[model samples]
Every structure is written in structure tokens, then in C-alpha cells.
Target: MLVPLVIGMSAPSGLEGGELAAVVARGELVWAADQEGGGPHVFPDPDAPQRLTGFEVELAELIAAELGVKARFQQGQWDRLPLLLGHPADCVINGIELLPERRRDYHCSRPYFAYGLQLIARRDGPLDTVETLTAPGPAGRWRVGVLTGSAAELFLRSHPELEVDAIGYDGTIDSLEQVKSGVLDAALMDDCIFNFYADRFAGLRAVGRPFGGGYYTVLTARDTPRLSTAIDEALGRIIADGRLKTLYDRWDLGGRQQILALRDAAEIPVATRRSLRELAIETLPLLLSAAGMTVLLACLSFPLAIFAGLGVALGRLYGPAWLRPLLTGFVEVVRGTPLMLQLYAIFFLLPKVGLALPALVAAVAGLALNYAAYESEIYRAGLKAVPLGQFEAAVALGMTKWQALRHVVVPQAVRLVMPPVTNDFIALFKDTSVCSVITVIELTKRYSVLALSTGRIVELAVITAILYLAMSWPLSLLSRRFETGQEQRP
Candidate 1:
């Protein structure tokens, strides 16, 4: 989802030091946001699918114009924005709140917007207020959904006595949909977001006073102090020129943002200090839990792929004439389409027909089916590489046709196939990260969540990369051992 700037029009400036200057030099100020968060902050414009239009989008544009550069937008998962800074984007402006920990990790601009949490519930639902369902009875049982890494979740998590069964999701629309459909008792998110959906969903209504939120600031990397300063100054000018207020009015972010912008109340959050060893010790357990899922994905699906692939390969090569073409078509179809589409089909699309599967089952099934196509090719090559004389020799020795293949050809072909098989197996380890789309919390997804939740993107990513290496290295060693043993075989 990292949409890079593709406009061919280039303008080059020769300035130095700051990210702002660098962006100006390149003729584009690349801003990153995750559209999944949705609504008045940043989402795709319905009338124009390819364009983004929100207060934050407009805010980025004004600042870019202030620095005399074009605004380029890139999309990354919301939890991964901090990681994308300085890599794919010069800064991020997706209504990132002015949290204490965020200020510590990133070179954040002064607050441009201020808002609070809005508790949203079904209009006809029994829950009317936060205190309404807090009574001591069966009716007090409430299942609330919150965006996984938001302050709403943090607030709810701090109060276990509330006995709220909290559900975490990555997007706003899903939680709202769940609330509307009675799947969730209520949903909590930003007031600005609630405003975007207020008129759109007649069944959903925002209730209770908006509470417990702070200013939203733009984030740049800590290394880019010069760029940070430029952002601060540009934002100041935008406020003074009334452009900031115009955006707030246009986007319905309430008049409170204008007051906060004019008042300029920005405090840097204190940074946490820890040794490398301390950091590693803190993060390893969480990473390890996620790594276990990744390993499970590879381990569960791979042998199935091997067995299915070998069967298909044999059928294609030596089955009845009518079956050969069918097996060949199966290989072509599976290989031709993307693995992502296959996952969506199994997990998202199939449920319409009542074949609903759990996330893990869908992920394993999708991976097995996808890999079987490639594995069949590897197997077919190995089968063909077996000299015909070997089969002839076995058949001449009173072995049945199936017996010759099972005992002689397959055993030899498997040896030749082992090296590539092991290599694919290792590659499949990393590929399991994509299973996050199906809600399987593999290593990479865990890293994103932990990184955002704890504001330790760099530390978590280093540990995660090591975990991935740890998963694949053993397979590499095993493959090398097989290769050496194969070479030593005669």
C-alpha cells in the first residue's frame, strides 16, 4: 500500500541539511498516511478514487506550498507510519495525536488540530451513555471495539473494572459496521471521525461528551531537526494566514483547533532511555510469539503443498490422457493469479456462500494451494531429469510401473528436488508475513503493532528482522547439508 510519487514533472533545488530542503530539491514533499483509519482526517475522496481529500491532506498541501514544493502522498498502514518516515515519506500528517511518546521518537510539528473521543453506538441500542451500561447487572455487559493503537483503547484498557469486552481492529469503518450490526455494543473513536460518518449512517449516532484527546501534529524523523523546524515555521505561517482555520472549517474539525493552533500549546514528551540489551530483552517475547505463528504457517502448509504437488505432477506426466490436460490447467490457473487474490477468495469472498473459515484455516489453505503450483513445477523438473533408462531398468527387473516410480524414480527425483524444495520452504517463511491480511498475527504484523503501540519502531524492527533471520537460517543450513550429502552421494 506504499503508493510512491509517480508524477514525471520534476523540479530540482540545491539546498542542504533539512528534510524540507531535501524535499524541495527533489520537487516533492512526500507525506504518508494510512487510509484505513478513515474519515475526516484522511480517506479517499469518493468522487475521485485516485485522489485524497481531508483536512490533513489539505494541511500537507498548504505546508508543501509554503515550502514551494509539490505535496506527494504515500499510503502505508497506520501502525507502520512511524517506520515509513524518512524512508518512503519525508513526514506523516494523518492526524497523529501529539502524544508524549510520539514527540519523543519523532521530530513532530506543533499541533495543528485538537479533538476528543466520540463514543458511537447504534441509535436504537440500549446503551445511551458511558455510565448507562456501567450498572451492576447482566445489562452492564458491554463489548466495545476500539482502534488497536489509539488512545481510546489505552483509556479502556486502563480500566479493567469496567468489565468491557474490548475488541481491537485496524480500521474505523469495520468497528462502526460491527457496532451498527449489533456485533459490538459500541465503538469509540475520534470526534472528527464520528463527524464524517454522522450524516452518512442514520442508524449510528455519536453520544456522550467528547472526552480525552489532544492535538494532532505532523511527524518527521528525529534526525531531521532542520526539517522539523521548517515544518513548525510553515505551520505557524499557515495559522497566522488563516489557512489552517479555513481547513478546520471546511473539514468540520470544530472551532477548538483554531484556538489551539493560535495558542501554540506544544510540549515535547520525555524520551525513554534504555540500553540495547534492555530493549532486546523487552521486545523478544512479543516478537517470539508472533514468530511462532509465522513458523506454524510455513510448517502447516508446506508438507501439504509437497504432497499435493507430487500428486499433481505425477498425474500431469503419467496419468490417463484425459487427466493430463486437466492437471495442466489446474497448474496454470493457480500460478496465473496472485496469492493475495487467492487469500481474499478463501477468507473474504467464500463466506458469502456460507463457507466461513477461521483466519488460520483460510491462511493455511490459501498458502498450500498457491505453493502447490510452484512445487509441482519443481517436481515435474525433477521427474523429467530422471533418465528414462532408470524406469526401464526397474521395469525390466520385474517391478510394476507404479512400483518402479514409487521405489526407483521418485526416490532419486526427490534428492534432486530437495535443494530447490528447501529454498522454496525458506522463502515461504517470509511469505507467511502476508497472512496478516487474514488477521493471522505473524511476525511482521506483530512488529507493526508493537512498534506503534510502544513507539519503538527502530528497536522492534531490528529484533523482528533477527527473528525472521532466525526462522530462515536453519532451513538454509539444512539445505546446505542436503546439498553436501547429495554431492558426496557418488
Candidate 2:
């Protein structure tokens, strides 16, 4: 019997368990991303509760049914889904495009659906067609908003004079709203998505025709060859037997047929395929460049965190009774919440409250604030670890409370906290990847951009990991040395 496998569902309309009955019988399981409210590629219909109804869901259900497995659903962020592939889910069934770079890390199922890049403009805008929008003049130079890390943004970036105002939104609907509110002149998005929202907004319209034919494929982990083959065959069968066509008709995706045909012929051209040596050489500079940014961010943020943590620790340990509670609550709140959400709040929400900050500055501030909260706890523990007799002895020697803390308490506390601080620094370095969501091109962000460009996520991610290890190993060694020296001095 086949081992039970989990397949991811991208949206509610795409696929579901009813189609995966065959796969369930064979001991396979279908797991769908809980995109209840819609994300970048998936949109939730208000009519449905905690379920999606897109092309991704329908196709995934069909695949699971064919494999005779039961289908299950779970929710995860779009960016986080890649990390979840081998763990919580066997394959991500979103309408993922099969790009050359992506093939390095994932095995993509045959193309089952297609969409194209389209321009969305406000109803009151003078620009309505692609020709008029791109025509040579100031009026034609409208700012086009796109989601960061998406193909649309990358494509726009390649054009120097396009006046792109790329925004990194957690969801496509949010990006669309920016355009609707006139915060952005226009938005470049998938045609299918534009159609879904255009009806509701009334002010938005798809400009010109769709371009850059894109197709959807199931993304499986690279190591799962057998599973990959099974998926491809199942998809091929669906297409050959006309079930795929019927599903598309039912979903009104017939307009995407030409793009699907183009996707069927897709493959990485030989000229673009680099050998291992070439790939390494090409990726080295990028990795190095991003590493420098990561180091810079960490260096700038660490000192701030340490200082803030020290202040918070002192306040909690020695402040007036009323103030102590406030400081303690502040530290606890920051520590309890996710660092990513905090960063998002700072980058996206803060600007609206008239506290705008540059992306890099916001990232550094968020990282520093997050680490400071944890570090305060660490410092407080370190402070307590110092014996009370030491302070008493300082007092006997005629030292004041402030002097005792500065001279006697702090030195010992530093030694006690040094190891944990070093460990925290290493973690902070890795956590810096979250800043990429706000457009800070740190080490991980650079790798992700390269991965999207080359479609080689596994190799690139591995290389990035190794680089991180190399950078952090020395810090680990230094922490050990500090511990040894502290022991010898005492």
C-alpha cells in the first residue's frame, strides 16, 4: 500500500476532497492551505466560510481523488508554504508557476491551468489601455503597484522608466485596495484576479490584453521523485481524458486556454541552464552581497537591542513599583507576539499613523525591539544569578547603590548573560530574513530573489544556509572563549 501523503490545496475554487476520493483509497491524503480570507494568489468568497473556491482547490481535490486518498485542509501563509512542503504538506496545490529557477528545488506537475499578467487601472484614470499607458509622455508615466517578490514586480523592475511603486502586501486584495483608494495609479496583477475584483470595485478594469502567459502547476519536494511522477501522470490523464477541460469550463477559465497551451510547451532553455560550477560562480557574488547587508543590519540592530534590554532590565529590577509593571508589560507584549507581525505593523501600519520610516530603518528597529524584549528577560535572570551578598559587600565598602550596580553587579551580570546574548545574536542573524517582507534585501531575501529568478530554491537555500552557518560559527566559538576566560578570571 502507498504511504499516506499530504497534498496542499491553494484555494477554495480550485480543488477539494470530493475529487480526491481515488487517491484517498490508495492511502494518500489531500491537505489544503487554510486560505479562508484569501492571500496573494487565493481569494476567499464572502459566501464561503474558512474555505477557498479557486482553480487551485478544484484541481488539487481532483488529484487527491485520483490517488484514492482522503483530503484534509490546513491554513498557512503563502511564503511559509514553501517551508511546509515536506513537513505539513506533500505538495502545494496553489496555481504555482513552473519557472526554470523553481525546478531546481521542486518537481512541478504538468500545467493544468493558466493566467496572464494584466494591468489594472482606476475607473477615473485617463489611462485605460496598455498602449496609452506605456506611451511616451508624463501622463503615460503612472506608477504601477505590484507585490514584492512576484513576477510582476520583477518584470516591472527590468524596465527602468516604468515608475513602478512596488508594495509588499501580505495579500493581493490589499494591493488592489491601494489602487482603488488612489494610493497607487494602477496595479499589475493576474488577469483572473483582476476579473474577480473588477466586478466589485466597479472602478477597476483590465487594461489591454493579458501578457506573459503563466501556468499553474503542483509543487512537490525535489526528493519525491515517485510522488512527482505520480502527480504528473495524474495531471496528464486529467488533461487527456477531458476532465481538465470540463473543470476549466465549469470555472470559466476558458479565456486562459492560450496561456495554458504556452505553459504546456514550457521548459528551461539550454542556454539559460548553468552547470553546477557556473551556478556557484554566478550565485557567489549574490550571496556575498546579501551577506554584507545581513551583517550590516545585525550590527546596527544588536547594539540597540543590548542597550534597550539593559535599560528595561534595570527598570524591572530597580524601578518604582508603578513603573515596574509598565516596563514588565512592555517586554512581555513584545516577546509574546511574532517578530514578523511586529515588523509588518511597524512597516505598514506605522506609516498610516504619521510615523513613516524607511524600510531598512523599520526592519532594524523591529529586529532591535523584538530582541530587546527577550534580552531583557535574559538580563533579568543574569542579574538575579549574581548573589545578594556581593551587593551587601559593596555596600559595606561604602559604595552607593548606583555604584554597586555599575561596578559590581553589571560586570558579573555581563559574564552571566554573555553566552545567552551570543546565542541570541546568532538567532537574530537568521531571523533577519523576516525583514525581506518589507523589501530589505538581507541574505535570505537575496537568495529568495535569486530562487525566483532561477527557479532553484533548494540549491540556493542550501547555499544560503551554509553561508549563515559559516558566519555564525565564529560567534559561537567566541561565546565559548568568553565563557572560558570568565571562569579563569574568577
Q: Score candidate 1 by lDDT.
A: 0.79
Tens-place lDDT per residue, model 1, 1-490, is 1112111101121223655667778999889998878888788899997887777888889998988898998998776677667776788998787776786677778888777888899898877787764564355568787876677877787777775866666788767866765656788888888888877778998888888777778898777777878888999899877777777777666555566544866565666856678767877887898899999999999999999999999989888999999989989999999887788678766765667676789999999988998999999999999999999999999999889999999999999999999999998888887787655778887777776766655656667877888889999999999999999998
Q: TM-score for model 2? A: 0.73
Best-fitting candidate, scored by lDDT: 1
Root-mean-square deviation (CA) per prediction: 5.6, 6.8
- lDDT agreement with native, every candidate: 0.79, 0.71
- Cα lDDT over the full model 2: 0.71
Residues 55-166 of candidate 2: C-alpha lDDT, one tens digit per residue: 6567777777766664555566554455456555667776566666556656777766676889888778776777665454354456676655565766676666554545
Residue 301 lDDT (model 2): 97
Task: Give the C-alpha miss distance for residue 170 in model 2, angstroms.
Answer: 5.5
Mark the regions of model 1 whose C-alpha exceeds 4 Å error after superposition.
Answer: 1-28, 117-188, 194-212, 240-242, 256-268, 318-326, 386-412, 452-459
The candidate maximizing TM-score is 1
